[model samples]
Target: MSHAPQAILARPALLFLVLVMASACASRPGTDTLIPFGATVPGAKLVKLLVATNRSGHEGHSAGSASTRGELRFEELTVSIPPQHQPGEIEWSKTTVRDPLESFVVVERQPMNATDFQERLNSRSNGAGSTGIFVHGYNYNYTESVFRLAQLAADSGSLDVPILFSWPSDGAVAGYVADRDAATYARDDLVTLLETVGSAQTRRRRLLVAHSLGGWLVMEALRQLRLKGRDHTISKFEVALAAPDIDVDVFRKQLEVVGKLNPPLAVLVSTDDRALGVSRRLAGGRQRVGAVDISDPALREAAAKADVRIIDISSVTAADGARHNRFVQFVALQATTVVQADAVTSLQKAGAFVFNAAGNVVSSPFDLASRALSSQ
Candidate 1:
C-alpha cells in the first residue's frame, strides 16, 4: 500500500488503535466497565429513541430471569461530543470532530416502560412516520448499544426514530457462547417489536439494522416470522446486515428462506473484517458469511437469487484500520473530500445496486462519497 504523508502518520496509530478499539482483551483481563448512562454533551442535539433490551439494566451485563422482551427504555442521547478512539471509553462533551473521525457522544438517558414508549411513539411519529431499529451484536452493553443507535440516527439525517434492541451480552470474549444463547432466547422479543412497529402505522418506512451476531438474531426472528405467516409485518422494513458473524453456509440457507422478502434485505459486507477472522476459527473452520467475498461465483449467485443486495465494502477504510464494522463512520471512499459527510443516508439513498466488475454491489465509492458530501 502506498503511504501518503497523512497515511504514514495515521496508519501505524490505527494499527494499534484497532486493537485497542475493538478487542475485548485490552482492558482489565475480563471485566466490562459500566460507563454511567445519561452523560450528555452540551449544545448537541438530543436524540430520542426507543430501547429494547433483555439484559438487567442495573449494570454488570446481567440478564434478568424474565427473558420476554425484558424491558424497554426511552433514551435521549447527545452526539456533539468527540470520539472515544480507545475502547471502553465514553466521552460526552460539546466538542465536534473537525477531523471527521469521531464517535457519537451519548449525553443523557431516561428509562421508561413499553406503555409509555408506545404512547410517545404514537404521538411523536405522527409527524414523520419513520423509525430505524438497530440490533446490536456481541460484546456490547446497554450504554454502547443505545449510543451507537443515536449516533447513526443523528448522522443519517433521515431517521425520525432510532430504536435499539439490545440483547443480553456479558461483554466478555469468554461469554461468546452465552451471548449466542441469549440472542436466541431473545428472538421472541425482537419479533414482538417487529409486530408492534409493523402495525404501528399504516404508512411509514422501517429500517432494521443488525450487526455481527445480532445479524443472526435478526435472521432467526425473520425466519420465525415467516413460519408464523407474520412476514407481512415486515412489509415496511428495509433490513441491512453489517459484518454478520453467521456461518456462511448457514447464512445461505437463511437467505434461501428470508429471500421471501427480497429488496427488503440488504447486506453491508467487508472482505477484510479482522474480528470475523476470529469467529471463523471458533466456528470450527467455517467461514462467517460477512467475511466472504461476493465475487465468488457461488456466493454471487446466492446473493442474486435471494435478491439480497450486497454492498461490498471490501475497500472501505476507517480511522480504526477498517477492522470490524464500518456502519457508523463517515464513508469518504478515500481521503479526498469525496464522501465528506453524513454517509448513512447516502448509503440508504444509494439503496441496493448490482455487483460490479469488482463484485461490489453498491455505488462506486468515489461517486457515493462525492454525492454524499455534495448534498450537505
Candidate 2:
C-alpha cells in the first residue's frame, strides 16, 4: 500500500483546482464602489479645468477639481459623458485588462477660472522653484492624461511644481488628424494658460513638457507667447518637447521665432516610438524631427544655429516599457525632475540663457550638464 505516492499525486491536482477557483473568485466584479475625489490631505487645492470641449462644445460639459494633496481613487472603470451632459457618476468595478493596456481615473474633476490656476502654480515652490506644465500626446483621454500626470509627478519626486493641462483629445489612432484639429482649436486655451502662468511675478521660472502632438501645441503656444512677450516686459518660458509629431522645417521655424524671447527649450526624442515611426513613414519615410539618432546634418546644422538641446532618450526605459512616454516613464521623470530642479536653482541664483544642438535654451549654468561635466 503505497499511500504516500497517491497523496503526493493528489496534492498537485488539489493545488491546481484551488488556484483556478481562487482566480475565478477574484475575477468577480464589485457592484458598488465610489471613487473619491478632492483633497486626500486637508487644505489642498484641486486643479481647475478651464476649458472642457468634447464632441459638442459646451453642450457636453464636465468639470471637477482637486489639489496635489490627495489620493485619487479609481475602481478600474471608464467615465463617459452622457449625451444629455448629465452629472456622470464614478463607480467601482473589477476590470480585466491585457498587459500593456492603458487605464485612466479622475482624482479631481472641476474646471476653474484662469487667474486662480495661475496663482496656484506660483505658490507651489514659493515662487522660487521651477514650475512644470505637462501637455500629453495623442490617443489619450482626459482621465488618462490626469492619471499619467499624477504618475509622472509621483515618480519625479522632486517636481514639487507640476501642472497637468489636458486638452480635448479624440483618443484614437485614426483620430490623429482630428486631434490635430482639436489642438489647433484649443490653441487659444493653451496660450491663455501659458500667459497666465508666465505673467506670474511670484514664480518667474517655468518649463513646459509636451509629448507627441502635444509638442506642437506647446510650440505653438510658446510661439504665441513669444510674439506677445517681445513687445512688452514679458520673459520667455522654458519648454521641453518629447517625441513631437511636427515637421522638421516647421519646428525649426518655430524655434527661430521663439528663440527671440530667450526661453530655454529642450527636445527629448527616441528612435523606438512606433507611433512617431509610423507617422514618419506616412510623411514619406523621412526620419522624424524628434528622432535625435538619425544624425541629420541639416537638423544638426539647425541645432547648431538655433542652439537647441537635443537629448537622445532612445536608450532610456522604465518598468512599463521604453521611456517612449517621457512623462509616465520613471527614468524620464527623473531626468525631467533634474532639469526642473536645476531650473529652479538657476532662477534662485539668476542664471542666463544657454543653448544646445537642438535649439533648446538652458537658462541656468547650474542646470547645464556641460557645466556640471566641466566642473567634474
Candidate 3:
C-alpha cells in the first residue's frame, strides 16, 4: 500500500489538528464530540474515516478507564475527513526488523457501524478500491497494532477500506494464554464489528487478515457468525490467515465451515514461524492452523479434498531472521510489489486465487487482470 509521502504526512497532520480541536471542544473525558462524517480534510481526495474504540480501557500508562475494567467494548464512534490519498493508500506488511510481525492502517478511521462503514466503502470502490479488516496476533500492544497497521495501509496503497481491530494483547511470550482468553471474551465484539462493517447495507468488498492467535479469534468469530446465521451471511466475506496459533483439527473444522460459506479463501501459511512452531510443540506436536505444514502432503490432501485454498508462503522467507512473524517479515520479499498490486486488484475485481495441493497458482476470478496487475 504505497502512498505519496506528501499525502501520508498530510493525514497525521490533520489527525493531530483534529485531536487538538476535539480536545478543546470537549472538556470532559468520554464525551462524544461529533466530528462531521464523510467530509474531506484539506489536501485529501477520499473522505478520511476512523472508528474510535470508546470501549473504556487503559490508554497506555494512564489510570484504567472503566471501559478497560472488563471485556473491551466499543461504545462511541466517529468518521474523520478523508485524506489526500485514495483508498489504495492502505497496506499490510510482514516485518522482519520489527518486533511485531505484521501491521495495517486506514487513511481515515470511520465510525464503527454498518452505515458509516458503507460510506467509506462507497467512497473507495471506484477503480482501485478494497476493504480489509486486520485482526492481529497475540503479544501485541495497542501502539504496536496501530503503527504496524498504519505502515501496512501505507504500503498496500489500496485506499478502498483499511481497518485494524486491536484486541487487548500484553506483548509477552508468556501472555499467550491471557491474550487468547481475552480474544475469546471479545468474540462478540469482533463479530459485531465484522457484521456491521460487512453487512448488505454497507455492501463493501471485505477481507479479514488474521495472524497467529488473532487467526483463531477470526476463524472462531466467523464460524460462530455463520452458525448463528446458518451460512447465509459469510459468502460475501474473504479471509487471509497468517501463522495462526490454533489446533490443526480446529483449523480443519473452521476451514470446512469457511469452504461452505465461500470458495477457498486465501490462507497464507509459513513453516519458519518459530513461535508458532513452539506452540505446536506445546500442543503435543500437532500442526497449528497457520503453519506451512497445512500445505504438507497429508494436510494438503485434506485441504483440497475439502475445497479450501492453502497458499504456502514459506518461500517468502523472513529477511529479518525473526521466526513466527512471517506476515511482517515477508514484506522484505521481492513479491511485495506484486502482492500489493494484487491486493487492490483482488478488491476491485472481487475475486481471489486458489492453490492446488502442490501450491501452484490455479485459476482466479480477477477482472481486468492485466490492467489491475500493472503498477501504473
The best candidate in terms of lDDT: 1
Q: Higher-TM-score candidate among 2 and 3? A: 3
Over 4 Å off, model 3: 1-55, 58-128, 200-203, 257-259, 319-321, 329-376
Ranking by lDDT: 1, 3, 2
- Report the C-alpha lDDT of model 1 over 26-65, residue by residue, as the tens digit: 4321112223334543444556777767665443333212
TM-score against native, each model = 0.71, 0.62, 0.63
Q: Which has the higher TM-score value, candidate number 1 or candidate number 2?
A: 1
Q: Model 1, poorest ten-residue lDDT window?
A: 27-36
Stretches > 4 Å off in candidate 2? 1-110, 119-127, 229-234, 260-263, 294-298, 318-323, 330-376
Better of 1 and 3 by TM-score: 1
Ranking by TM-score: 1, 3, 2
1-376 per-residue lDDT for model 3 (tens digits): 7675446335543334334433432322121112122333454333233332323443323311122314433322222213332222222222322111121222333234545555654555555455667787776555445544554544444424567677766554445556777778767878877776665344445667777888898888888887787354566566666677888788778866655434345556676666666677656788876665653467666655665556555655453333555455343222233334444344333222332223333111111122233434
| Range of the 10 consecutive residues with the lowest summed lDDT in candidate 2 | 66-75
* Candidate 2 per-residue lDDT over residues 278-316, each given as its tens digit: 566556766666665636566556554666655555444
lDDT of 2 at 317: 48
